[model samples]
Target: MHKPLLTTDFLDRARRHYADEEAVLAVDGTRYTYAELGERADRFSAALQARGIEKGDRVAVLDPNTHYHLEAAYGAMQVGAVHTPLNYRLTPDDFSYMLSDAGVDAIYADAEYAANVEAIRDEVPTETFLTNDADAVEGDWESFDAALDDADPDAYERPEMDEDEVITINYTSGTTGDPKGVCRTHRAETLHAYLISIHQEITDDDVYLWTLPMFHVNGWGHIYAITGAGARHVCTRGVDVAETFDRIRGEDISYFCAAPTVLNMLGDHHAEHGGATTGDNDVRVATAGAAPPEATIRTVEEEFGWELKHVYGATETGPLITTSDAKRHFDEGADDRFAVKKTQGIGYLGTEVRVVDEDGEDVAADGETIGEIVVRGNQVMDRYWNKPEATEEAFSERLEGYYHMGDLAVVDEDGFVSIQDRKKDIIISGGENISSIELEDTLFEHDVVSDVAVIPAPDERWGETPKAFVVPESGDPDDAGATPEELKAFVRDRVADYKTPGEVEFVAELPTTATGKIQKYELREREWDEEDRMVGEG
Candidate 1:
């Protein structure tokens, strides 16, 4: 009765049970049922075989959140090829490096980004260069649609797949250096999909909006979880506030995932537009990449009548480790509910999460002690692709088996995990540790601050001091927007003065990865460009 777990089973289930149900609502206004989508995948798989793509060969997909992205992923993986989803925002050089590094044999790109691959086609070792746009092919490149048309859906056969085999390799955004590919096995991905479904309470009737990019950890494994539940997937070209509002009302969207920054944009837009009717559709949103401020959570629940679930995890951890659910808090007051919804709640089912110190011992649950968040579960990745030393180091500085999350956090008495900051983003000022995330979160309380990033700046008197870069809502620059002294005074009453930034630099925008994570390293590099080392010894 025991069978190997594979990701393909999810798609198969959708095809079998929900064959005639609407599966995808593409940005181009095309809708496909589960049966139709499966047929397209079959044709794509046959086309890959015709083009000489063999088992275990890497096939790269470069596109936005589109039906083509989903089809390419299911098609490539069904025939035992390893699917690699590239970040379309990356430059041609990055594409070339990743293609060569992964030994990619075939590439399928969207029309908007095919030129990026074309620029580096000669430098990479890839063979088949195909475009989703039938009319956009250039020199030697084939049309993806035409190939799909020529291929027979029934001719392609599924290979005997090993659950332990790597199904997808997702490259990091590489804010610091060249990106590293995180190899995700079929077993891990399947388990992660189940976790997402359980935590998000997905159902067949639920409609999922593709606010998150599919290339990022396969949309945090929602692609499998939603499809497995026989839910509807509405794909958008990209995240847009106006488009999101229209879809939520028009399509009656039930669930979606996005960063806190995106949530803030939507919330701000909703406020400006006078609270459009969601039309009896109970919307639930899952947010990560930083906890939304208590005020943002309050606005979302009170004004829009939407539920906010704050989850936490990294790309290496199958990305669905912990969720902040309001039911566990047992609080009824508005302030108490808002505060509880803001913390990265408790561990997901079958996951063990802890905040531990350098000694590998658990920190006290007093909520004051900060430590690295470590976790272990079926969802954790087996290893980084071709980087044994890096893989070993990732699991080294911890207890025997747990993987370190590199994020500093504190577990409260109720088991609520709140992230203080990333390990590298912490600021050391006069021998006292300061959390830049804490400062950023506190600064977000200011109405004028649309965005903010905090980093350590060289301070002759205090080793290193906290410095703040802020983006004002009014688009004013050079302190004409919000004076540094006014912002400093605002924070002085909220948190410890030591935690407050010594200097505030107003910028139009903060440097961010394509995934919308603030790149503190870039800010640090600029501040320390003139200095040999960041800080001096006492």
Candidate 2:
């Protein structure tokens, strides 16, 4: 029989499971025993309580992945406080909007980022402030360690949490349009964590390199699973390719989850300087987002001996609903292997995924057909905060119960899901839903371009035109540049003339979110300010 599922219950069980085991290992050679972790978490709970934080009160944290940050998260969870982790890299203006929207009452931040929140603290609801480094804190922020220093290392009595109660109010950075708050429940988080622990094979024996930020779907729901499974967590604040390599070797890290970009960075780093293959140091990389290009997937596996596990999900879907891990799919011919790897994979145990056409009828799973992918499961968000109309439209009377993911995709007969084109981000020039990603992917084949973000620029005749933001790779090490004409000519020769960017802007970097997703909305704002229509929305 299934037992009672509870957040604190998982904590208790994990504590027993890994009693003598080291539950966390930091990059700087620090370790926290499972028993010690429980104490630190409890101390954090007391610290928050002393600061007047109460159950269900929203506590916002703005810190990168660190051991203390993990303690703060579990502490907030223990008190039933809603954990709202903010991206520290966000400007004061962004913090202002998010803090006001979430009604955050208390905050914890790192030394590097305390100032951003400090600039807007007076205007925000945040009262108690804790910055890990006191000397770096400004605007009445106090020391973080001070609170926990004097507090007793005792377990906080966990409040009764219903399955549907909101545990996290994760804010999307709004890469396309207005940012929406995703309210994930205890049940959804627990189950998704359970899915990762089981599917990813996380256990006490496993040591995790905390590469992904905790703010992102709770580190793609690995924080809970890693902690729930009593696995060791090695903390670090940045993702330096060299540092990542050293930490993997230094921490003896066995498992890590990374975006396709990170995998690409590692692959490039390895190409520049040789590294290990087929050893404990040869880690398993769980890649998501943009489905690591076929070449990327192959290179990572063959060169580094990385066990590449491809999976896909969104912020609203509790992040780990589909994975390409079915054994039969991989056991086929080489063409079939590549074909299976291309899909977003199959649904998790309790998750249901469907591809529906324009009329909402289920689409064929021939792998060639494309349709919008919608999901119905325990992992679905409760609703978009303060946006009932969008929420209603997202859930259908036809599915009768499913949540509609705005993504368009297709599936193979073997049940692997493949993302096609985004419903929006589709460029319309003379009435064609031109895929900007397709054009951008094609343009990436050019050697001159280091990185690119494709956006729809305003046009008088066609309503929109493709615009390219190109960053030239530093070739000379001292010289910085890419001529717009060079970028334009490079893309023109490869793609259709119309798809070639009407305007090319040379920049050092394109703006991106914490998760490394290109902030297309920022680019769209500059492109569509004068236009009557919005470029990002369909």
Q: Pick the candidate with the highest TM-score.
A: 1
Q: Model 2: which residue pairs collide?
A: 344-417
Evaluate model 1: give its lDDT: 0.83
Candidate 1 residue-wise lDDT, 256-323, digit = tens:
98776676778778778875737458999998765666666877777888888888787889988998
Task: Report every candidate's CA lDDT.
Answer: 0.83, 0.75
Model 2: worst 10 consecutive residues (lDDT sum): 529-538
**In model 2, which runs have C-alpha deviations exceeding 4 angstroms?**
1-4, 175-177, 277-282, 332-335, 397-400, 426-538
TM-score of 1: 0.80
RMSD of each: 10.9, 10.5
Q: Candidate 1, which segments miss by more than 4 Å at Cα?
A: 174-176, 275-277, 425-538
Give candidate 1's error at residue 434 in angstroms: 20
